[model samples]
Target: MNAVGVDVGGTKIAAGVVSPEGEVLAAVRYPTPRSPDKLVETMVRAINEVGSGKDVAGVCLAVPGFVLAQKDTVVFSPNLPAIEGIPLKERVGPEVGFPLTIENDASAAAWGEFRFGSGSGVDDLVFLTLGTGIGGGVISHRALLRGAQGSGGELGHVTVHATGPRCACGNRGCLEALASGTAIGRRAREAAVENPGSALGRLAARRGLLGEDVTELAREGDGVALSVLEETGRWLGIGLAGFVNVFNPEVVAVGGGAMEAGDLILASARREIRLRARPPSRDLVEVKEATLGPESGVLGAAALARNTDGAYALGG
Candidate 1:
């Protein structure tokens, strides 16, 4: 039977039904509700929307926060404050209409990549999502490590600048604060406002600009946009350098909507990683773009469900 995968983000919940061979059959999305109860209701609704009345072997949820899959709990979620420490299984099971599993959103994406995407068959790999906020998942020794506290690859929270902007996690200089899509947009907007006559500013002055817009501008060779992306890549490189030094992953797969920058974002990240990391480790690692695109989270969530302890439970 197919499994249902739901990727719950700060703003939306994207759900899909996936075949055992990794094909997405049906998909749906809904705005995330604010209240904890409403969140569960929304998820149940989303699951049924995509599940299409099939008896799903399991339904997996990829949540943005610290997920304790063993206990089926969301320890903390800065974006979804109401659900912090909420017992997910206890709250979401009754209405979900099927067995369920929960996992960290980034970890889910990493698992998806490892199973069928860029890092497939790789024993050691790293996955980073450069979307609303930077997130990460890692695989070492051919196993997913969620750490003792189940937050192993929260690489975005790693400090990149000691006195940089404050992050949502209440910390200063985190990678998420520095290199995330939001960060790039923030920098782009600032540039557009400060120098409206420049190429990047002209594009921004026409309408509101997003991180993707900046990438588009960079692709067109807009000077300001290129500069902003280069800076963004620098931070990514600095943060990833630390990972390379530590994990020595064979491949680093970058994903998320913002990663659409393609060569603009990745090329810079690769260059910076090579410059900052040590010889063999830096030379050995290959940073590549994830092929799964937006569906990665949902697919990985399905993997989490199908491979949970009963499936492939990866509790550290």
Candidate 2:
């Protein structure tokens, strides 16, 4: 049987027809609409477009927010605010006309990695997504861990420092505030302003840039740019060390745009994870980049549907 997975992101909505074996058979993408109703319409169109000629078993949506399991309402979403507290099942159920499931985007990605990507074969694992902001998912004993309120595994919000930068969650020193791509970019821009002679400054001068651009320059041997990445990686490691102590997962799978910097970022993170994490957890957990890349969200949502019977189960 086939399943339809939709990745409802801040900028775009992507849907794909996924087979039981995790292969994407068909895919469609569209800009996400602003309003809740229009967003649902856009998602439905994408689902129908990709699933038109395929035999679909169910539909799964991977959204970024605190999902109320029993109610299937998106309680809060920082990126897509208009849909917060909206009845997702009621809005999309009839339009899709099939069993539906909803999952947090990070959790969906973790499921994808656990089933078919880098974390495959690992019973306990953590999946960290380094996008504009940080997001994470935890899998323990071959099952996804959704906490008491279906809001577990929010590693991004984990406090990394007592007196650090403020976060969108209205907290100080969150992992996301310190090490996310946006954070890295903000720091890079500040560095460019401070040191005009540095390679990062020159690059920023030629074109107003951010973390990705700095990473590209570093790949070409830019010292200042490399330093920015190293700093971000170090902060990332600091956060992972805390995660290691708490979850003790078998593997830490890093995904998203930041990992594109390759060793420029991973080398620093690996060094810190080894230095700070407890020996047993450090030895038990392996830090690796995600193999599924951008497709993880949709693929994992498909995996959720393929494994479950279309019911949204928080912990099964």
Candidate 3:
């Protein structure tokens, strides 16, 4: 069966019709509106545009923040406050003329990886997206591990440093606070200030640095920029170490914009996991880049979409 998946991000909304084999048959993109009503309207339009003339079984929305799956509502989304509290299924289902389900965006992406990407061959997987903020999801024994309230797999919010920076979620020392794209930018800016003679410093003097800028500088062999990424990677490794010990996943797939640094970041993360995680789990788990890139969200959501009877059309 084919299903429609909508990945709603703070900046853009991407919708796609995906086949059971994981091929995206049709796709559409739109700028996300900040207002609640406009957001709903845009989502409906995106779904219609992508699902038109397709044999779609159901539609699933992959949204950020903490989702209350039973209620089909996003209780909290820091990056996309406009989506918070909206009954997404109720708002989008009738207009799209399909059965709908809601899932945490990270969880959906993890499912996408599990079914078709890095985790395809594994029953146990851990997926993390290091974008503006970190998003995480877990698959254990071939099932998505959503906690009792459907808010589990929030790996980013776990405390990694007791006295680290503040997170957008109002927590301190969270993995998101120390290792996300936002965190990289913040660390880069501070590094630029400390090493005013470096390439990173030269760029920061002209314009504010973003995570991408840090990656670019690192690629040019700028020592300060490389150091920034190394530090971020170590923090990421610290967090991954904890997860490796706890979940013992066969694969830990890292995705999103920050991962553009690739091994520059992951090499250190691997080192930290080896140092801190238990021997068996650390030795067994493979930490690698997620292959689907930005498409993981929509693909995962589509894969997880369910029928009217709540059966997954394309099982995870």
Candidate 4:
């Protein structure tokens, strides 16, 4: 069966028609509007473009933030604020004119990977997305770990350090406050401002330092940039240490734009996990880059939509 998936991000909405085998048949990208209603319109527009005015078996929308227990509404999202408190599935389904499933973007990506990408065949696994903010999803024994409150894998909100940096989640020392792309960019920008002659600083002088810039600089052996990533890795490793202890997953797939740094981030995180996480389990889990790249969310969303059970269940 074919299904349509929409991944709603702060900057863009990615919509796609996906085959049962996880192939993306058709896709479209639309700019995200600032207004909540317009955002729904954009999502519907993308669906129409990818659906080609044809009805699919199901539709799914993947969004960031804490989704409500009902899954039809977004409880809160630090990244995409407009949709907060909005009943997305209810609002979108009428205009979309179909059954709809909604899930956290991170969960969607993890499900996509478990079903079709790097984590395939794995009974237990974790997925961490290092984007503007951190996003997380966990699968235990082949089931998506949706907690009683539907916020089980909100790894970004986990406090990695006491009295550490403040997170957008109204907390101090959240993992997202330390290891996210936003954190890396902040560190790099600070480094550039302090040391204008350095490689990272030179790039920052040209344009603002982005997480990618730090990664590229670190790759080129820029000491400051490398240090910043190493710190981030260590922070991630510490956070992963807790996840490893709790979930005991077979693998942890780290994805998102910042992962372009590849081994630079993984190596440090591995080191920290090894140092911090308990013995056997820490050694058991391997951290790898997510294979599906940017398409994981949409692919997973499509998979959710194609589910046999009416296809609109929240937190499925």
Question: Number of the top candidate by lDDT?
Answer: 3
Cα TM-score of candidate 4:
0.94
CA displacement after TM-score superposition, residue 42 of candidate 2 (Å): 0.9
Clashing residue pairs in candidate 2 are none
Ranking by lDDT: 3, 4, 2, 1
lDDT of 3: 0.93
Best by TM-score: 3
Model 2 stretches with alpha carbons more than 4 Å out: 306-316
Tens digit per residue, CA lDDT, model 3, 1-316: 8999999998999999999999999999999999999999999999999888888889999999999988889898989999999888788888989888889999999999999999998989999999999999999999999999999999999999889899999989999999999999899989999999999999999988888899999999999999999999999999999999999999999999999999999999999998999989998999999999999999999999998778998874
**How much is the lDDT of residue 123 in candidate 4?**
92
Candidates' C-alpha lDDT: 0.84, 0.85, 0.93, 0.86
Please give the range of 10 consecutive residues that has the lowest summed lDDT in model 4: 307-316
Clashes in model 4: which pairs? none
- Sorted on TM-score, best first, the list reads 3, 2, 4, 1
Task: Give every collision pair in model 3.
Answer: none
Off by over 4 Å in 4: 53-55, 306-316
Comparing 1 with 3 on TM-score, the higher-scoring candidate is 3
Q: Give the TM-score of candidate 2.
A: 0.95
Q: Which tens-of-lDDT digit does each residue in 1-316 have in candidate 4?
A: 6888889898999999888888888999988898988988898899878887554778888998998856578888998899898887678877866677778899989988888888997899999999889999999998889788776799999998889988998899999999998888887888888888889888888987777778878988999899888888889999999999999999999999988988888899999888888968887998999999889999988888844467432223
